[model samples]
Target chain A: MQRSLAARVAARTAALRLTNEKLYNEILERRKAERALRATERKYRGFFENSIEGAYQSTAEGQYLNVNPALARLYGYATTAEMMAAVGNIARDVYADPEMRLRFQEMIERDGKVRNLEYQVRQRTGEILWISESARVVRNRSGKIVCYEGTIRDITARKRAEDEAARLRQQMLQLQKMDAIGTLASGIAHDFNNILGGIMGYVELAQDDLPPGSGAESHLKEVWKAIHRAKQLVRQILAFSREAAPERRKVRLAMLVSEATRLLRATIPATVAIEEEILTETDEIIADPAQIHQVLVNLGTNASHAMSGRAGRLLLRLEHAAIGGKKPALKLSVRDTGHGIPPDILQRIFEPFFTTKGVHEGTGLGLSVVHGIVKSHGGEIRVESTPGAGTTFMIFLPLALEAPQ
Target chain B: MAHILVIEDDEHMRGSLAQTLERLGHRVTTAVDGKVGVASAAVAPPDLVITDLIMPEKEGLETIMELRQHQPSIRIIAMSGGGRLSNEDYLHLAKRFGAQFTLAKPFTRDELKAVLAQALAS
Candidate 1:
């Protein structure tokens, strides 16, 4: 019996040892799993903090819940917490247009996600910037949307570049249309000149047959003078369309203006006065002499026409101006005190064959020729006018690099 | 007064021009266009041929060339209202093509007389 009792004790001891060994193994396995899980958490945290693309999570109500440093820097903030504090109301404080945030939420709600949404947002400095965002709705365990996760890319520079390209394309199209009109104008002026030549010739022949003091001779002379004026009109159109390669040379603008205005002074009526103010330190430019002469005459003729049969004053002024600290330019101004051109008509003053004068008085090529000549010289022309207050036309031409002494 | 042939395309221009020349005391003959002018001048070869440069069937420039080829000694005066190239220097080419003188259309009776006088004196 004593022997049986000792065997039973040994069996019970063996059983207790087995249970302790099994419990120790289970604790060791649980410790290994905890270490592996810690490593995984560190890897995911590094990815969340260091990504260059702006990463963010926002509540369904558009409140920013979490934002990476890249996102903080994008809004011109030094830290993510500071940006979060300043931008409490995302719709009011972040987006330039509040409607954009509402659209973002509606998109994520309807589509379950939103990618590449373009929007304009205001920075902390009050500067507007364009951004492209990609995002998806974050859902709870029950599949209900709890927040939105998003990424942003600033695209302001690319948007500005596209806008400038469109503007240049529009300008190029306008220039091409003007060139077509010039070619057509040259063809018509040629035909008109020939017909006038016939009329003038016959009138001159008829005048020779009349006696020296006859009333018929006086009438023919008046008709002959009128024909000469029409011939001048045709000449203006020819000059505008000729595209005759300009003979470029050193041009003295002051002398040209002086000669033109002196001749103009004679033609101007007694009531209308002509004044000159030559104040330019640099008055020379490289251009075609004949074309510059034509520009001055054409501008002067327009000023005279604006005051015909009405009392007015014509002012011709010149000055040297340095534009934006670049090369010096000469500014020539033709100002007149007369009934100013109406706003609608002023826009079309440079169009070829567009005129308001009586049919026989003008062919409307005068201002068009002036504009063409100025452009050929690499110059710019602008006008300032107010109805009843008169008009002022300003011409800016680059000064010659080396003027002839 | 001289025997002159006027070759013009327009009938009214031809008639009035004929009257002007005849009133200036010259025996004048007329042709409706460049082709008839060349044909008429070839028949008799008038002393002075006043040919218009722009005409139907045969142009004035060609008419002048044909006249020079046929009647080398016939004095020629080329007149043009600038057919297709009014703005071009077409009148200068007329003199180069053997037209003794070139005149832009719509000339006074006195201007015509001077050219004829110069032609006659030469």
Candidate 2:
């Protein structure tokens, strides 16, 4: 009986040892699994922290749950924690337009993912920047959206470049269209001049045969007036089409302006007050005096027309200007306290043959000729108008260097 | 009175010009084109020649050069109603080709008289 009892105790001891060994081996296996899991987590965190693109995790309500360092910097924040604290709602605090966020959410919900969604967002400094994002909706086991995860890149420079290219392309197309029109107009003008010459010659001969102060003489005077009008129209068309190259020389702009203003004074209505404010000490420019004179006359005429039938002030001013470290320039401004041009018509003012005046009042080539002259002179023109107030035309021309005495 | 030759393709313009020259008290001869004008000058050699720039047979520039070579002392006046080029441009080119005077067509009688007198005096 004693031997049997000892054997039972030994068997119980071995069973206890086996149970302890199993327990230790289980602990070692659990530790190995935990280490591997921690290593994988560190690797993913490294990717999140060091990525150049902004990585983010936000709730369905547009609250950022996690943001990488790159995302914090992109939003103009110094720290991820600071950005999280500041940006309470992504749509309100981040998006330039809140509607974009709704669109983004709709896209993700419908497609389960979004690739390269472009958006404009407001940065921390209140500056708007363009950003491109690729994101996916994180769903729970029940297929309900839990959050959104995304990577974003700042694309403001790219967006600006694209916009500038499009603008340049549009400008090129406009130039080509204008050139085609000019060629066609010039062809017609040449033929018209010939026919006009024949009529004018005949009319002059007939006038010489009629006695002065007779009723026929007065009637011939009217015919002469019509012929003069036709002549002026042909000349204007030629100028607008740039058929005749301008003869450029060293021109005294001050003298030209005074001469033009004097003519304007006589031609425009006497009711309109004329004011000249020539402030520049050196008003020399290497330009065609005739073309420059025409520019002034055209601008002045338009100013007078704007003030017609109303007692308004016409102001002509010349001043020196510094323009972005470029060549020295002179700025000539024609301002009138008359009815301003409407916004819709202002943009089309430089187009050839675009006129708002009555058929007899204008030929519609004035501004177009002015624009062409300015462009050929390597200058620029700008117009500003306020409805019911006035209109101002500013012309910038390069100053001519002093010639040798 | 000076003997003059007028070269013009238009019939009415040629008649009007011939009458005007007669009124101005000049002996006038008319030609239909540069070819006829050159031939007439080669035969008669008038004191002054007023030729249209754009013509059917031979243009004014070529006519002026040929006429200048034949009669270097003969005074020449170039006229045009303009064509592909402006009248001023054509007149400018004509002046370069030994034409002593230039006229844009449809010129007033006074303008015509002025250039005619200048050409005769020169």
Candidate 2 pairs with clashing backbones: none
- How many clashes (backbone N, Cα, C below 3 Å) per candidate? 1, 0
Q: What does candidate 1's lDDT look like per residue over A241-292, in tens digits?
A: 5554568888888987887676566455767788899997678889887678
Instruction: Kindly report the interface RMSD of candidate 1, rounded to 1 decimal.
Output: 6.3
True-structure lDDT of candidate 1: 0.77
Per residue, candidate 1 scores C-alpha lDDT tens digits across B1-122 of 78899988766556667777887888998998778888998888788988876666876777888888998888998876542223234565567677888776555566778888888777
What DockQ do the predictions score, one after another?
0.12, 0.17
The TM-score leader among the candidates is 2
Q: List residue ranges in candidate 2 displaced over 4 A.
A: A1-33, A207-218, A239-285, A288-399, A403-405, B1-19, B22-100
Model 1 DockQ vs. reference: 0.12
